[model samples]
Target: MNDVESPIDLRNLKDALEWQETANVKRPWRKDFFDYYVDLIRPRSSDQCQILELGSGPGFLTQHLLSQLPNIEYTAFDFSAVMHQLAQEKLHASEKTRATYVVGSFKDAHWQNTLSQKYDFIIIHQALHELRHKRYAIEFHKTIRSLLKPNGCYLVCDHLCAPHAMQNDQLYMNKQEHLQALQQAAFKQIKIPLEIQGLCLFEMNVI
Candidate 1:
């Protein structure tokens, strides 16, 4: 967690696995907080719904979501192969399972060209802060907008940079920073209903 000039390489199997385990053990509140947000925004009906989870490390977010809304389709996308493998192992096979796991990053040169389907809910939890730079974060917000259906919603929960914090490789955006990016991406009805433990939860509509 030192102030390195680049993002951490989470592609390593050992490191990725260890990071997931350590976060679970050390940050129990993190799970509870995220679960609360997921429950607040989960689908309301048994009707089929499409969801896309970005940076789904170890499937923790997806699992919490499915536990609440068991009848929806879930797709997970992550850049790390090891993390994706871990997520696959942790997720169970169920009759309600309509899941797709893709090992790719939006940062890739032709990543948007690879995805065809849009989603009703696009989730990014605890991952946007690792975007490496502010510009990438803004671009990602735009990308998420493009991936959502007309009435789709996007959810984001991540650390917020303290005001006056010096610029570094690690990406952390405060409320205003995120608001600017989301506005530029054309997201409407943006809400930041919760901010605790130096993290914030955001929900916005694509329309």
Candidate 2:
């Protein structure tokens, strides 16, 4: 989706389902890591306040977040329909009403046509690395900047790797690379306030 492209196949429904189980097995560490992102969320002014989660998988983190911040409206987007189905199953009946699930890629040609509103917060967890093209990292942050409300937060929790390291099926960028990409997207007040294990958490604001 950026000026430089790499061909990679996205995960299908079957792979998506399997990945959920794997993430579950690491829930103890994963939950704490994910919680770091949620902890920084500011409470919204209304019950209808919105949150957008990109690459949401089976609602693991979303359900955990809803428990902490119960009233806000939420939208979960993932490329796999099976992930949405699995997320629905994981969320409580009452909590389900607060969420809307969409199946699509943020980098898709039609992505901009689907989103109609900006969000108070946009969160991504460990999914960025799966992007086939590293250059899309820059483009996707630009997309995110436009989707955020003024002064809203964009939080990303992902693994860091050597700058030149190559990983198939993933876009691994070192800290400097990440900063450069986010800055190029015009996000302000950028900071990496937390790091746990190999995961680095980025907090940037739309000004």
Specify the highest-TM-score model's number: 1
- Expressed as tens digits, the lDDT of each residue in 41-151 for candidate 1 is 554436778888888887787777777677678888898888877776766677236678888876676676666799888888888865656667777887787788888
C-alpha local distance difference test of each model? 0.75, 0.76
Pairs that clash in candidate 2: none
Q: How close is candidate 1 to the true structure, as a TM-score?
A: 0.87
Model 2 residue 12 CA deviation in Å:
4.2
What is residue 21's positional error in candidate 1, in angstroms?
0.8
Candidate 2 per-residue lDDT, tens place, 1-207, comes to 434343433356677666776875753477776667556663463355688999897888778877677767889988878778888887887788888988888768758567779998899988776565567788888888888898889988777775333333245777888888888888767898887666788899877
| Root-mean-square deviation of candidate 2 | 3.4
111: Cα error in model 2, Å: 0.9
Residue 90 in model 1: lDDT: 67
